[model samples]
Target: MISMQIRRLTMLLFVFVFAGCASQKSIVADKRLEEKIDQNFSDAAAQYKGMMRRLPADRFPKTYYAQTDKFQTGASSDWCSGFYPGTLLYLYEQTKDQSLLLESERILKVLEKEKNNKTTHDLGFMMYCSFGNAERIQPKPAFKDILLTSARSLASRFNPKVGCIKSWDKVKSYHGGEWSYPVIIDNMMNLELLFYASKVTGDSSFRNMAISHARKTAQNHVRPDYSSYHVVNYDPETGAVKSRETHQGFSDNSTWSRGEAWGIYGFTMVYRESGEKSFLKTAEGMADFFLAHLPKDTIPDWDFNVNQSGYTPQWKYDPSKFAEIPKDASAAAVAASALIELSQYTNKKQSKKYLKAAEDILWALSSPKYKAATGENGNFILKHSTGSVPAYSEIDVPLTYADYYFVEAMKRYKELKK
Candidate 1:
């Protein structure tokens, strides 16, 4: 009887171990996931159609305030202008909707002039997202020239002394251009354009600039715990650090959620391009930090400083704001898209972990709690995205980039599942 009991106990233990291993390998999903993705794509088509009808001849949609029923638009020079056409291209790619294509082409015409506009550091956001996707889908020679010009324009912002791309010429809060040679965390997101330029033209200059920027950013912008500051101002002439501040976060020391998300996407892309283990490690660290902070719903607050101590607020400290801190679905969407790419560069176990986290976020954002109803939300897809809480801009609104990354994540998730 003792021998028989031992055999049964051993068999049960083996079964339990096998089950645990199997579950770890599996991504979080269900029958409803695909249905949710498809429904989102369909809703995107109709929503964008409504946006195009109202989009000014030379303007791009930025955000929509549902409470005020306001649709904010900006010129092609606006940093967010590329996201408008980019989101439309993504929708067109998924749905093959000709209207989305037409609108993207029309918007691209307005945005194309920025290829030669060298005054701003947002050329990548304004040109690449608009024309890069165009080149991928259509592959025209004109698109190549446009992208090359945009890349050159972007590379112009790189200062060898600083070993980073200058993020802004003017940051009034930081005394722009005088004491502030601002290098923002978001600038890392622009390196893909440079890498593309180097690939097409066989120009090591562009690639070198991107590598330098990534390396310097990894050194200065990223924190020890893998979280990041929003902006780092450097002395352009002396190549010395000035100050690190979070202009749009609650505190200067706080990890603004979107800025952190940018770091994850940027480092992941850098690793993919350079195949350097250091970049991969950096990306993984950033991803891990982001994953650790996610709430039960898989979304995050505008800044990770809400409840944490040791944070010094730029404004008056207010405990009440933490009671119901606004959530940033945009940041969650961006991280989801980035984590999918980051997963490809990790080991089997870590890859599964990253992909599962991404899956959970995608699942939550696709639900009705975050996604807006079709034809509502000023025709934007996801709702409850916070742009900059400290700046008091686009708070709790539908952002164009939020929709862009969400759709990109859906496409990536579906492809990975297949």
Candidate 2:
């Protein structure tokens, strides 16, 4: 009996030890994952250095396409203008390189005029991305003033009649009709700037506007499956939704990948700012819809609702041929960054799942299949990001925003590891 009891105790000890090992294994960083993250940052630094050498000192890079590896420049008013400096700040944060900081400051000086410009709804992209990151890294009173001014400029676009910020000043509808007031899902991202402004200035107006816009978007822009419409037109008189359509997606009914990414990122940000459970639930739902439809490699095609059975790259114009569609690395990067932040705010089970999904995407993007080698892909970090498939714009190219979010995601991942 004594021998039997001793044997039973030994068996129990073995089981407990094995279980503990398994649990620890699940949380520990894999050697391969660590190597991939390090390599990605190293490659990114090299690529940005090459970009700095190639790009004209006066212009900001927008995108790169085709076999020639040519860099495209955009105006200061362009929605993507902030990404150039924002990306530089991200790199500077990692490397502490003074040259990168100087370059970003030069660009920021040029972008300062947009703080008062009211022609567009992209002040967040233009001001916050640049100035916000600047303040985070090196605080300056001037950056805060610029950010506050930008928030006021953005607030001017908010029409109480529509209950949402107007996206386009003018709309030329493809359906041969005029849209009175248009709100795109992408506008959800701009609310971050307002939330920040409210916090710093002790102004409830900015916060109220952000909450109202979010609630309105949550009511109309999101579908039952958590997919988002690209644009929702509202009546200027009654604040009623007039029509739902997609200008940059496969069709009016299809789900645009970048738009969906914007929803996920925006809602996740909303939850962060407000600590609202509803916002968290909304973000999780959209994240689930996005993850459920991802390709095997974890990156998404330009439009998730597109029928792959009889689709082609030329189908947008030809309508008769089958062509392979391109993946949107920009969307993947944005989603990955959002998921990393979302993981931090959730319970343990969900935190693990979200973090794992983000890690998978980062690993996939780090692979040669998507990560551009140094001096390649027009000196961009990642390749094959689709901007707008239906509009035939920036299709299958390297975009500046892709690099920005990729760097941001890697930064967030590193912080979590620490």
Candidate 3:
């Protein structure tokens, strides 16, 4: 009887040991899957230092075209003008590098003039990304004033009749006419600047305008499947949607990858700033759509609605031409950052899923496939980002915004890990 009892004890111990080993193995596997966020941050800072050295101190980088091995510069009034200084500020935040901070301040001087420029709908991208970040890092009264002025300038573009801010100064209408006022999905991102302006000034007008724009966009821009249209034309006099079409996607019904990312990021940000449950729900739905459509590697094609087997313009109706379409790393970066934010506002189960998805994308971006070699990719940190493929512009390049959001996502990841 004693020998039998000893045998039973030994079998129980063996079972417990086996289970513990299995659990340990699972933890190891999970850790391997986790992204090395801090390592990526270090890598990004080093690459940005190189980029700063390569770029002319007076100019701002917009994109790096791999085919030409050339870096493109944008004018001060260009929508992308803020990304350079914005990136510098992001890098400065991570590294606390004095030179980057000084360069960012100097770049701000060049962009400061746009505070009152009302012609473009991109003041948020032009000013907020740069000065907003600066204001967050270091409380500067001048930066606050510039942001307030920029918000008012952006507000000036909002037409009461259209219930949305004008995205483009001019756009060819779907009927081959002209649209005096048009709103794009991309416009959703500019609302944060207005929201911030309202908070700083205790002005309800800016907040009201932002809420109205968000409501209108939430109603019109998102489709049934959560895919967003690129452009929505509104009758400037009547406040009616004149036409819903796409200028940058494969077709009116097709999903442009970057446009989808913009919608996801924009709505997620709106929910963060406003605490509106509706906005959160809208963002969640869009996130689901985006996750479902992502390619096997988490990177997405420039336009999800295009035929993968061949390239063809839906409008011109040309014969299918066989070629591989480029992926948009910018879209992936934007979605990754958006997902990180979204995870914070979701249930535990969803939070885990969203964070895991973000980790996967960030890992892919940091990998050799997307992360450019030192001193290569025109000194940019990322590669293979597509910008306006339909417009035949900046295809298969490293975009400034891609690097900006990638850095932002990594920062957010670090914050979450802590």
Maximum-lDDT candidate: 1
What's the CA RMSD for each of the models? 2.6, 2.5, 3.5
Candidate 3 C-alpha error for residue 46, in Å: 2.5
Question: What lDDT does the true structure give each of the candidates?
Answer: 0.88, 0.87, 0.85
TM-score per model over all chains:
0.93, 0.93, 0.91
- Quote the RMSD, in angstroms, for model 1: 2.6
lDDT (10s digit) by residue, model 1, range 104-152: 9988998888998777777777877789999999999999999999999
TM-score for predicted model 3 compared with the true structure: 0.91
What is candidate 3's lDDT per residue for 364-406, written digit by digit as tens?
8978999987778887889999887655778788999999888
Question: What value of lDDT does candidate 1 attain over all alpha carbons?
Answer: 0.88
TM-score of 1: 0.93
User: What ranges in model 1 sit over 4 Å off?
Assistant: 1-31, 174-179, 316-323
Against the true structure, candidate 2 has what lDDT?
Answer: 0.87
